[model samples]
Target chain A: MNYNLPVLLIAIPILFSFLSLILGSFNKILSKIILISVIIFNIISGICIYNSVLKNGNILTVIGNYLPPFGINLISTYTSISFLILLYIVFLVASLIFVSKNDDRADKISSVLLLYLASSTGILLTGDIFNLFVFIEIFSISNIILISIKDKKLSIKGSLKYLIITSIGASLYLFGIGFLYGILGTLNLSEISLNFDNISYFSKVFIFLFFLGSIMAELEVFPFNFWISDSYAGSKNYVNILLSGLSSIVALYIFIRLFLTVFGYPTFISFSYSLPFNVKTLFLTIFGLSVIVNELAALSSKNVKRILGFSSASSLSLILLSLSTGLKNGVMAAMLIAISVIISKPLLFLSSHQIMKGKGEKNLNSFIDGFRRNPLFSILFIIGVFTLVGFPLTPSFWGKFLLFISATEKISYTTLILVIVVFSITIELFYYFRLMHKLFIKDENIKVEKTKNNFVYIFSGILLASIIIFFSVKPYFTQNIVEKTTEDIFDKSGYIKSCLKSGEIDDR
Target chain B: MMIDNRTLYIYSFIIFLIGIYGAITNRNLIKILVSLSIIETALNIFLVSTGYINGSNPPILHSGMKLISPNSINISDPLPHALVLTAIVIGVGTTAIGIGLTIKLYNHYKTLNVNRMGDKDEL
Candidate 1:
């Protein structure tokens, strides 16, 4: 019951966001210092919460001293705390890279980054559904602003599309919340889960549909992610790291929280005599199509940023595909894949910008003789690609291996999914290897600028790569962590009991 | 039309569908933004309506009212009203951001038609 950690984790960054803005008006360097200090504080708080969770098992903080089912609450389980820690690390690296650049709008960017961190952390920690909606809006608005910070025409258009579509999705989500409130009479997540079976069959199905449709946009699944490539290509490279690395992880975590935890299958299976359609199968088909379509699109795309964007989307789909299996092992495999993606995607993005520095074009042609220009970055990029393709001695390899094992163990149509995954992986390999080959191809006539190496970029890239390699070499450590997280996610009764017990404390 | 609880839900649903239809069919960026606002309005109405109790008084306590026990008085649920207030504020913020983006897009392309903007890569 370390009361300060959860509230401070959310409040500190938010307080600093405004503080940084005012401080930036006085001195820009002061604002940057505040941003760095906030991130460092976030890391320390994240570690403290992790330690508390290890000792005390899931800390639930009730806001305003009101009992649960009435007051807003924040819960930090092992899974959420792990994601928070990972998010802090990525933000630390991204902030360092941002400070290294001498952009005119550094103060503005620092404010937006802090707000982004605060809202996303709020989304992860809040246990109330309505609070989740508020956080989602903040997250989306900040994301749009972040995308449009460069004030370029394309970035504006991209952010416009993103804003309009995601706003509509948020409205749909609010509508779903209305229905849930009407039926369940409470906004607390665990309270809703406890009373979920009391809802009528039709209402339950509709609520589930609304939630799925709303979240699918952020998840970057098929039908709602057409704007993703544009946004990725239009924004600055560090923003891409946020979009691909940090935000996507949070989005997936929210999806898991809603689907696997809130409207879980265990509750549904008991109340309903028979389901009209298989929900898991439906999710599987959507994710399957997402994987194929995104990978194929990446294959045809010539823009370097767009290709990486599509690859990130496809990786998200792969994680979703594994999660739809509803087996413990599937959840484990999904976590494994998600961790590797969270690690390597940002590395690739950071290094891609480095490799494309001083280049006029962002096409594959720009990558020619990349190895000659900066050998360290070229090697880092190759390692990133290899990890993405799940080559041996990379963390992604173990993820894919565990995924294949888990998929074969419990899923129907395993061969069909296996084929789709393998086929898509091969297509991905073709394009990635082609890029690697272009990097090695000698082009002496290409005058590459000998740009000074940004220590932040190189250090972050090398750090992530080394982490990936270390995990690959000793995957048992990761396996044990993922196993525990999976158990935490699957323990629905335990989650409810803990939340309700915390809620009951005030009454006694 | 008699406006009962069920009827209110029906009206909101139809409005929501119209918003969705408009959002899908409109080519102009402003029209799309309007459609999104309409959707938000529909949801807000639905949410506020959920808090309504038939013939119940507004949620308030007057002086000299003695509370004997919980549920002693019939009052409409105030939680959904609070939620709707927040929703309306958020809706305004989103609309403002959308309008800002629209202005920027119009200034850049000199047109509001979504189709005419062409591919972002080509821009």
Candidate 2:
């Protein structure tokens, strides 16, 4: 593979999204075919990029013939490539369900999903600050369209709220970008990082605050996450995968990528200057509150989607808390938890979607006699919830284990965070088991129609389940990659050098 | 007299604050969207002003201009101008979507006031 593969990974999906829309106008099946093909093509390219990065150290593809500092560039490092692979895999499974299900606007949905794929690819790969902003705008706009596609009152309401909140977030981010550009006179992330220390301390604080406001909304952290439950409750199941599974992971990736690389302290990156405050402690406090509050919220909620929404939020906070430990092990733990969430949340959403069919209400009671109706779905649901609650064989268990081990190492807030974590886990276990219990509860005197499982649903379920089981059986497989990714994230000099080393990769 | 960069920054900041105040105080969805647009415009103004250089020409080279060294080309930075263009397009797209959602909500609820919508459920 050539160095152009990084850009191709972004361009192909965008090209295909438009193609699918134009073609799907003629025939609906064409859009489905295009979505699958585009995703498959992306997966192949993602693997190639991964291999190329592993072999060639890092691949930088400069756009528009401009050198790295002046032009747009895509950097495919170990960290980004790994996340890209995981994202495409999730997209593939979600597309399987998306393709199988029929909707009046299937063509539009296909195109939007394709655009989402492109925007996410851009988010992962781009090295330019302004380019990142543009892709984020596209990502959120497409997200708004997807959430309200159902056209129901609740969905519209949720989408409207999401629109308002995200618009504000995006605007704040723009203001931040304006400030940065005004001070730094360059839009390139590496160049900015190189000159970050020259700026005044107050400017640094204000810029970082702007970035925090925006990322907090996108990251769906506690205070800025009011849009999530309502939006998740109102969106379609696969879109839930897009929101909780895809977007949250991407947002967290953004949080890590930007914060660690651009604004990281000297302890993390030798050249980067330390921030005025302790970011780790701050994140811990905020994320700890998010964990406890979200889990309690989940425990109280009865709507299945809202419960799952709260659960996903709690898992995201748990991942963030692990990240806040600011240790390699903490990142590894975060990866473990993130992987578990990316796998299990989709499984839960898809299975619950199948189980909730023909039921007027979306609640835990909808799962009564669920096993009798759709045995495969119920079993999958059990495994998913079990994985979430940190069953011993699951990756979440390993994640929580690693988190506690790291948390014990000489942090001032150790016991406090541990207590909060323990309390959160206890609540999680209670509620998830309560949900699983409802799956097997016998409903008397009701002759329930046996719900037929679509082959596509079963295929996707098995595919997702085997991923969880594979990691469960062998946790070390992903641990190595996560370790390398953590190293890649910390290697700020290497990132800057690769992006700034002009035309060497191009000759190849 | 040509406005200095500090004056431009302060003005834009005030405009941004006004937008934020409007967004926070407004109960109507359309009003909120308009506030968002105002915020976008303020940011764009701030961004474009960041590229400003007093008495400098627009970052353009026409045939009538005498050939000069690269350092001698007295022009404002063009990058933020380009950035503002992109931001404007994005702002337009976001506003369009916001309006579409507002229309849908109004058709469903027969009211535009956010508080008039149904109360939040326990879920």
Candidate 3:
């Protein structure tokens, strides 16, 4: 069987992660070198793979010499490849953040970071339902370990919470897969959808619960959102950056795949045609309320991490709102918002952490006196806040603009209502700006205390913020490619042709 | 005789709910970990049992049993078995790591419970 570019893209990371384990991924320099080399190699490979996919339309790669739905196929439609490429950037930036002049654990943490990238990238590209489960488990395992590398108490507590809580969520997904498999007799999502015109009510129930549970954990929504706040509040700032920014985006990507490709549940993906009052209205109502409440939570938060946590929730709501659109515009908007959050959140995390001492908890007030003395930091923080708040000219502003406009075209009243409810939460900005006002007002009084002026830390934060802005203007920088990736979402024949063909697959 | 598939599913759901309750309410980290294991077990059982038919043998083929036709053995589905084995490995890894962390946490915090570990600001 020929290798599918997308499957290979997914395989490259997992393959390296496994090898790193054999060669000691977490404790040595040799392993760290291997790990980084492998990721860089894959990133290069992903670039080429993405190019080929764009030119050829789509490609499929089957594992174990078997055919589709049986052999565990990996389909590289545009979206997964786009995410794979985006993930490489996120992980690369994160690596720069972790490496430092005085970082003793740099070797070990970089190794784990590579594994995180592999698992997350795998999540984006895998087509088999069971394979997706394996990727999710890998992601949870690697990330829990990564969080533990922070502070002793923080690591232990956060890791345990992450491990146990996410394992429960993963179990739900496994149960759902079992239910789906028993009835449909297949583990491939594409095949399952093709085989059954409509699933039984029982299967529907399983699908709804399983997908919701898993995505809920990753997205940090209402039910499972409990774990992430403590994590963000407790873990080192850099770790929180990885969790809030990159991890959640990958999870959202997986959610979109499941929502649109597998379940095809119109409840989430918005359609252009008139949806029935109860059908469309109910879902939007709940999603809209989530956006409002999450914004309010972000506003009310006292701790910096908790504030970012709530901000992430708001971003999650926006992406969910975009996905609920179900139209072409919705898919594009989802990717844009996801890219925005993942890129900007890291900038905020690393910058805040660099400013504050490695304290157990991070509060907005923690950085008081910074605005007046450190205009550099002040500018970065303001830019970070601006991006988070979706101020004009930021990545999120454009991202949310696309989503709001797409949403309004179909359901103007719904969009207006959500926008108003969300705007009301700007009072929360008082909490953040108050910190800024304090820093600026007290600028000269406080001294820059004992701190590590590491080049990597400062450089990483600046680099992260710069990338955020760069993408904002020329979002077409990656947007051109990512949006191109979304176009292949409905191209099922491209998957089937490559899967069924031996050498000359019709990659139309 | 018809098997009660519906009853099997109800039983599975009940087990899952109990596991969730135990996980949420339990105080000890090990006990919470055990509850998580229960949840994993319940999910695995649901997956494996879903692969079962009224009358079927394990999917493995004995050397002497290849005499006649391919379809007549009433072979249980092998896919869930493969999937479950992976799940089991994953579950063991998570539990092992959790227990190790709990032990470390106990040594550090002087308590196996979450409440005492907090406010230490030790991280």
Candidate 4:
């Protein structure tokens, strides 16, 4: 059956996202049940679609018969499918966490929550830049709302701050697209990428800056994202899970689409040699620096979520660093890290929520007696922290190994990289062991009663631990999928031929 | 382009710069909002400018200029303008939400200055 799967996966969630909201308002139990069903269905269908695409090589679910370059299109290439599957998994966990007894806004906030998922998933699936903008707007607005779901005064303030900054960010993104369209006269990504070389050199430089202007806001790397702390700090844990997990993934997806596909290495700039490095080298250097800066801030952070936030951002910068290499290996490393963040971050988030009484109380000492209070969960949390820190045999260790090997192989400068990796790992290990030691040893040894672990929490415990260990051992489990995905992305002639010469435009 | 060529791009950028300046420097809640509006306006103008056609009318395609130079066939790109309109409505909607929040915040904290609005832990 010609299932038109791209739009189907996106549309189903989109519909349920709204349906879940309405359902939650009327019957909370039904809402939770339907929401879980919808997410599970999403996961199942994503796998089906992914398996189909894996066999077929590429699947384009063009919206309403729209063709490429001119008409809006949605292509379900391998990477996006992989991303969708990851997204659904995270969404499933998030759904569980949101519907669980603890979250304050789970019931009240269900309306827009599903919509946010649809928007983010839609952003990942769409083909045209303008449509991407639409989804970005939707995702950003929904994200801001989701962040503020707690309805506390501080939450509202933080949401507003996020809304203003990201709204401006989205507008700037649109405005930049405006110029790209002005010069190239098309919003279709592949066509503009082809035509990019023909544009003026001055415009090329401006366009590069335009990419920086738009993506930097989402990257939250430095000066552009000064609001990251204020925005991410006080948000509810589940929404922050979405923010750090799915939303960041969506943003990085857009960055990859823009940076790699449209303008990987523009030849028009005359002063290219002015910089001592190539594009990939630049990605390595800049992101390596962010590793230290973010780690330093993360170490000093008092709020546990903010520390996770910083660490997420820190790890995110490393992924970007890996991507800067512009090699298949680098992309492989990036995808591995992405999967790690998707799985492990949510586990940690749920664990953190379980461990804490309030937002700010999740200090190092809080987890001192965690083993006694909830031994299973506490052990799972340690595994999660170990995974994050890249302890040997964990999936992250392999991912980090790939990143290190890729960087060394690509750059091939033994002394320089030796210093960079050491410093970066040191910076990472410092905060990690600090938090680790705190978990293991503390002056205030308070006794705690054994609380009953939720079935869902136990479920998450089993799921994340296995997946962490699974991918760590067989890196090729995901590596094969990601490698195929990157191969598809780099297939330029295939895309152009597929778009322009696909016989009758299969506009399903 | 429908608009003067230089003004279409340059002015929007200038307005964007002004909005950024205001967002960074302004201490008043309302003023920052006004600046956000400025930024949105600039972006809207920029989005629409990409769709403009020189000496062309809106993309009604009414057979009004069939005999005109088809090579110079000018129809203001309706797609970009439509996207811009959607963005403007969204801008208005988010702004309204922001205003609603600000009102709540002002009532609770009794201040319009964002700096003075919240406690250390909450903010």
Candidate 5:
């Protein structure tokens, strides 16, 4: 039998999410087993899809026998496959942590986790615009449930805010889709891209704004990110991992895909026939402002989780800054920064669960005597901090180095943006160092609790840190992968041609 | 104004703005949810309106329909109808989740006013 990797990648998890729920009522352990096996199967299939794409170009799997432009299809490229693999790895590590802990709500959490994975994977693989919206809704709903798993007042409020704001954003996006379908009469992404040039300038700008405004909430940008700090602080560590690792990456991917491919650079339109505003410049300005705002928020926040949330938001804004450049080098730099952030942020979040063992408070004071309790975790936390701050010998350092180099190569208004970027980094370093100093300070009044070092925390933290180290030591390997993914992202004509071809084999 | 395509769009836009106004200005949680539903319904109407033609028939080919020449008959676009169905379903799910959370919040805070639900100081 022919194996269809893309369909199986999505279908397996969705199938198991329900199965796990049913099995959970009977036996929770059996549900956990089912969840793990499905994840492992997804990982293996993701690798197979990646290898196949590398060997035989892009793979397109139509849902039914209908041809492209008529049937919904799943297209897997190098960049998407890389994201898929990263998502699987992160989910696997997180699941291990979940299993090692004993909670009364384990069965419910496991099922929601599976659905989250499935929806995110669907977002990554779908080739139609409407399908993307559907998956995004599923992703948001599951995320709301995940955040409110504890049923605390704080979690409930956070989830409520998230639900209301995101629902509004999704409706705005659906409105934009209605406008697009009315004008182009097609929902397929490739078909839309093909006809995008024919749209009037006013309509183009309106559609772009609508889409940008909607996605900004998910990407955790300036205006729509008011609830981020609360959500991050209220949720559990594992849920934070899912938020920072999987959800953020998927949202960023969608942003990049929509901007870089669908309403792409206006090559066919004349340069002089500009819209009322320059979208590229507008994006850069927004991202630049977001970077400064996030850093300042992080500096003033007393809660550690809120600080981390702001830092993650700042990192996302910086990546968006690079992407706004609309050049190949800029795309590569964005990918590099994205990878480093994805790897290091989760490590910091996971290790914090161990580092802040007995601290009932999430403020900076909790870290006053942290080093005395867990020296190893403190060290790992410091390392993760250094990586985020772009110190030498870390993946973030190389990523930032390339970003600055690319920014300088442009030699335009980006110089001012670069200055803003550097100044924000300085602001970030100030609080990070303060936290570090707090960690190492010796205080006799502080009672150091002997926190048990669980295998799950140490294993996942060490695994992620080691991976970061491997990438830092071998920058060339990271560079090569980023370059290939960048190339794949920018090849719009190739994507359109490959997706629109008729009568392709099912590869099932 | 007579009811026309332009009129439908105008009315939907007005309703959408009203919803947004209510969502921003209202202090009650249930009112905000109702406003959100209003916005959703307005968008659904707008989407379905996009597929409507002045003189077109429903996009169904009956058994007695002949394979006429191209452009012989005007038929409304069915894609947006299908899309609106999906959007309505999603809207219902979102509303249910919103109401569920509102109930829980009311139970905890003893008030439906968003401003009365103070910031959570304790986790």
Candidate 6:
């Protein structure tokens, strides 16, 4: 109900991360308690902020009373708060999976997870551009640490590659921010968006390209995503959930915020200077290529996690493709698809992790007789895979439906992209169904060991599955939020006014 | 005689490009990490120079100093200096992590060259 809630959302996790580290030194269980309690607190605060934003509109909390356009501020809009809630839920589930591990470094992992939560919350809430860069670095560094913390050779290699790529991306992004700061003399996002149009066309294009290059690397889009498959496959199963589900969502949020709102796409197209090429067409080609390449890669990959990694890259790219259409319907579709990913990715990884327990290798044949051994988990896996492939009674189905509808309304290269997307989806279908078919194979030749069932995995799987099924049973439940988030993203002027105005909702 | 901002900009850009080239081309992990740090330093230089104003006093207030106006100030912008400090701190953190990981990696593969790490991952 108060304006300090945004700061609390970021600060609490950070404070507790250190507290968790200290407490874990005394008793490892204490650290797990602190981690869960902090995530629960985040969910509660997120609900309060969501309620307040619904009543009072976007709330801007300027830090240390420095005021907007001069000081750092956190903006809690409809889109960001809802995603914060989703991320908290996912983190809570992930922490549970993480807590159940038998590793001696559990305490340290808890602290890292809490730090990841804090940085992600910061990335979502901050309205300052340089602050966003800082949060992104924290986010990426934490990810690099998590990927290799187990010290497996494969994971260390993956982590090394991630470190190099992200470091380069962050440097390029900072350079872009510097370019903008030199030109506009401000780092507040709303102020930049307000004054973005006055800059010379060349500077605008250069800055945009820099921002795009950096974010695409972060977003795991086609050209700059060399680190994805190795990192995804090499990390722990729970870590894969955080990487594919939470981090990609936050990066996509940044992409939308910077490209659609701050740069003002309408102003971009309406520029009187003759453009070098069509921006929308460029976006469509990039994302479309990602979709095609990743889907085809997913189809050919033998490793399950690698397949999921490639699938997630393509799914996020499809979301980007829909977004490039620049229609309200397209944004709505993107929101639905993102929600599907945020829910289903964890379920797939969690269930598959359970199914693969006691198996020597994480491959397709390992899934044989999965239904006979762990029926509930196999069912959950089916739901997750179906949701990914856009079967009926799933949010992804509706997302793809809306995507097709929106693409048809445009009736141009979008249709061509849509055709490519549809072709990719068929490939997606071929692979996911192949995975599902492995689950049901009645293999009588081999004696399967009874793997110990992790109740945490089962409980989290059911929880995530029910969320998907709930959304499927009641599509409108999610649509209301998705529609509002879409509007919040597109309302660039409203964002500028709220951010630059001497805060009406300021706590001070 | 002073070098203009154009030359400085070009210099930083060239440094940035060199870092990128080394990062992409180097097969040794430590070399790649060094390239990344080079890139970070180049960015910090670019950012600090962006806020530099010729012949302007550092952004500090003294007694009897006249303000340019209510909204605009006569002193050089201090924000980029603060930003570059934070960026340097972050760069240090990243570099430290890179070194730690490299140590772990060397223990595993016994080689710094990425090409010699061999294909542990397969299709």
Per model, the share of native interface contacts recovered reads: 0.85, 0.80, 0.85, 0.63, 0.80, 0.88
Specify the CAPRI tier of model 1: medium
Among the candidates, what TM-score does chain A have in each?
0.96, 0.97, 0.86, 0.91, 0.96, 0.96
Error of 5 at B28 (Å): 0.9
Error of 2 at B23 (Å): 1.3
The DockQ-based CAPRI class assigned to model 4 is medium
The best candidate in terms of DockQ: 5
> Please, what is the TM-score per model?
0.96, 0.96, 0.88, 0.92, 0.96, 0.96
Worst 10 residues of 2 chain A by lDDT: A265-274
Cα lDDT for residue A313, candidate 5: 88
lDDT string, candidate 2, A111-149, tens digits: 999999999999999999999999999999889999998
Residue ranges of candidate 1 with Cα displaced over 4 Å: A265-275, A447-449, A502-508, B63-66, B119-123
Clash pairs for candidate 6 = none
Q: What is candidate 3's lDDT per residue for A91-146, written digit by digit as tens?
A: 76666555443356555565567667767877777778888888888888888887
Model 2 / residue A137 / CA error / Å: 0.6
Error of 2 at A372 (Å): 1.9
CA-lDDT, candidates in order: 0.84, 0.85, 0.69, 0.72, 0.83, 0.85
Quote model 6's TM-score.
0.96
Model 6 / residue A449 / CA error / Å: 4.2
Clashing pairs in 1: none
Instruction: Point out where model 2 deviates above 4 Å.
Output: A266-273, A502-505, B62-67, B119-123
Model 2 interface DockQ = 0.67
lDDT of 5 by residue, A1-508 (tens): 2336798888888988988888889888988898889999999889999888888888888887667888798889888999999888888888888888788777888988898999999999988999999999999999999888778888888898899888888988888898898899888999998888899987888788878888887778898788787788888888888888887689878987788788775342111123467666788888888898999999999988888888888998988887777766667777877887888788878877677887788888888878888888898898888888888866677667767777776677567667867987799899999988988888887666766798878888899888888888898888888878888887787788878985566545
Interface RMSD of each: 1.5, 2.2, 2.3, 2.3, 1.3, 1.8
User: Candidate 1 on A104-147: residue-level lDDT in tens?
Assistant: 77778899899899998999999999999999999999899989
